[model samples]
Target: MTKPGAVSSAQLSRRSLLRRSALFGGAALLGPAVLSACGDDDAGATAAAASGTKVSTVFSWVKNVEWAGFWVGDDQGYYTDEGIAPDWIGGGPNAPENVQVLEAGKAGIGLASDTLKIIDAAAQGADFVMFAATLQESPVGFAWLDPNIKSIHDLVGKTLGGDSSSPSMIDACFKVNGIANDYNFIQIGADPAPLANGQVDAILCYTTNQVSVLEAQGLTVFSATLTEFGVPLYADALIAKRSFLDANHEAVVRFLRATIKGHEKNIQDPELGARLATEKYGVDLALDYDGQLTENRKQIELWVSDVTRKKGVLWMDKDYIAGPVYEGIRAAGRTELPDVNKLVDLSFLTEAYDGKTTLLSA
Candidate 1:
């Protein structure tokens, strides 16, 4: 007898509607023509010539509600006003990874979320530095059905399913709680079938993503954000190569200024982005309006924090990174920890807001 809210194998296909594969470092490289700029070409070119430089921003995911701010920014002419004709290249499961795009000089800015990967690339002499983050804290976490699995510690002797990055994050979580790092982990991609049918106990997921999919399919899923599990990472991280930063510092600041305004717009009208993504930006993907709206609302909660209220939007705290973030990765068996200062630069965001928390007009 299946318990209430338990998902069966027959219901697995329901999740495919919102299933998004995690972006890896070695995905196929895509060309510039894949996704055009969200901004007007003629006007943006003129503005680029007058004040800002043209930049390419390679997104880490599909052009769904995840990129609502960028879409809003383009629609509002924020990028053109800042003199940037941004080519908003969208990424998907088969798209080029941000690291390769940036390293190959294909993009000036890239959205990367994995802190460990950024550090690893830096160790290999990639010369990348994170400037701003869309979400103040990571939304990635574990989703489970067992009522017994209340806290992260409860998964002590259970089989967990996740993508490629789950093991290190779990190791980090265990280390922080002073729990013995002992558990079974398997790469199960993004499906919740194994978990629903009892092949695995839990699966790593994003709060706004897979969890939402499960709930939409009549499954009541309990989840804990990555911060609660001791791995507090900044998601939707905006990164660029050091040389690009050196050459186009002001352009980068201008881009962030415009992007922050777009994010502010998203906060005011969550459904606006969902509509934009569904009707226009991601129209070909056949995204569900209601699902995107739910994801946007959930993401808004992750975007703001006490730090953002004081330091301004997209603020990256060095101390926070040095403490919990680095500790988590290092505890996960990583040997070298990159210097936080070298890995991040908050000055770009500082210049964008001029020491204020918002650019929205009152």
Candidate 2:
């Protein structure tokens, strides 16, 4: 979500509203010839750029605590250690879509949040390739003030509020439970104040964002995540043009190596990570320090999994993609699926970890 100002009732509501209206629309692909977007011998030039291999990475949102790991990696000189130089481009409500930037050669790599939209682009023949997913589980959830609504099924007959994606999530949840759409869903523009004030039964929100804000206001918020409802979708995917990866495979691996180190640093000390964002990288954003710290702690919860614990952070599981990820997308509305093989390539992360779960090697 895009932040407006410091954490306050007005800021929180504004931020959530901006996030809801942020719908993804497809951008035209420029094709393999678009490699010119990086200039001649793109790979060679990137490797030889003044300080180190210059790699411009585009993100789906602003330079806030959401990307603390990357900021930490840059600040810690992790990229330099790997003979790489990173140029971070921030995206937000007014920015072009991540894929559009990649297509236009404005960025070599991108971090995107919409898995279904990525598949749609690939299905339409974009050269995008997802190398890793930062968030292994979807954080989309329904928060309610009622203690009686313990699970998803408990809200079958209740009124729900959410943004554009909320309906798909609800439909997917109901599809899995073999139940009909029995609830009244109004697009409340991602505001949970209605739920808190008893105007709506539930409102869809991210536990890391809106829920945290409500709870910080001393409201007892009970929620269930999409994964908990049997629909797991990936978020914050790291992607790049297939042509770029084909030419600079080694650079991609090194980039992941440094990035994983950054995440490890954040996981070990979240307070320091929060400071890195609010105090340095995102200083101009006027981000709330305590809010960012709380978000950092909550965001960490979505980055790890049993798969990641064994394979390392940002691990790509083919089985998981083919199963839950694909199923969740299908339930959401996309029936035609892109081949998972073309959509994801795990070679970069595989080489980055080198048969080890932890990159530092103790």
Candidate 3:
């Protein structure tokens, strides 16, 4: 029987195109009418000025509840209020990497999925800086249909399905649980069909995403979140190239101000954010409204935490950033870590809120 949070590769692969379409569809959103007319010699400079200082942000993933705040900000004209025209670029398999997009001057800021990627980029001489983390904890986890598999320790000899990124998380789980590496890993995409069909014992995926898909399929799923398993990784950080930040500090601050406000609004009414994302910005992406709503609520749970409760959403303290967050990356086999001081600049977030902490509600 298909368990809750279990999906076949066929189901996920089919929906995968919907996500990719949003990435490619971003071009349609950035047509001439939206972008300001400019000469080739100073395209970036003129584009920034033409539309009241255009600021393009490339997301790490396609449009979904993960970007509910950006959609809410756009719909509510928060970006306009900040005196900037924001272009939100979606990411997918076919989309260029977030750092590459930023390096090419396509985006002023990018939403990166993990600190590892940022660290790697910095090591490779990319002048990128993480200004804020949207998700306090990562949603990466292992989802299993078998009741026997209640924890990461239970999957000693079971087949774990996931993509290239899955192994590091699995290794982290073993290390955290003080268990040996005995689990067999099968290369799989985001699809949980293999697991559902008994092809694989379990699948590694985002708890906020595949969990809802499996539950919708009426399966009983048990998920082991990596965060609880000894890998407390942060997800979805706001990043920008150093050059971009240096030239447009005010624009960055303004952009974050509107984005945080949007997140605040989304926290108040997730259904509204979901509706706006699916019916408006993601209208052409063929999104499932009910599913998106479920994901939106789950995503909010990841965004707010004890830290965010005290300092507001997207807040990160130096101790946590340099400690557990960095250690998680190291556990994943990354050795050349970026300097914490050079990697994160909290001044933008500080400036956005005027040094005052806004408590998260709900």
- Kindly list the per-residue Cα lDDT of model 1 for residues 203-270, writing each as its tens digit: 87666667676666677678887787776788878888788888888878888898999999988998
Candidate 2 collision pairs:
none
Candidate 2 per-residue lDDT over residues 204-284, each given as its tens digit: 766567776676666666777777777777777888889989988888888889989988888888888788777776666
How many clashes show up per model?
0, 0, 10
lDDT of each: 0.71, 0.70, 0.68
**Which residue runs does candidate 3 get wrong by more than 4 Å?**
1-50, 123-125, 331-335, 359-362
Candidate 1 lDDT trough over 10 residues, lowest sum: 23-32
The parts of candidate 1 lying over 4 Å away from their true place are 1-10, 14-52
* Candidate 2 vs 3: which has more TM-score: 3
TM-score of model 1 vs. true structure: 0.85
TM-score, one value per model: 0.85, 0.81, 0.83
Q: Candidate 3, 335: how far from true, in Å? A: 4.3
Model 2 worst lDDT run, 10 consecutive residues:
24-33
Better of 1 and 3 by lDDT: 1
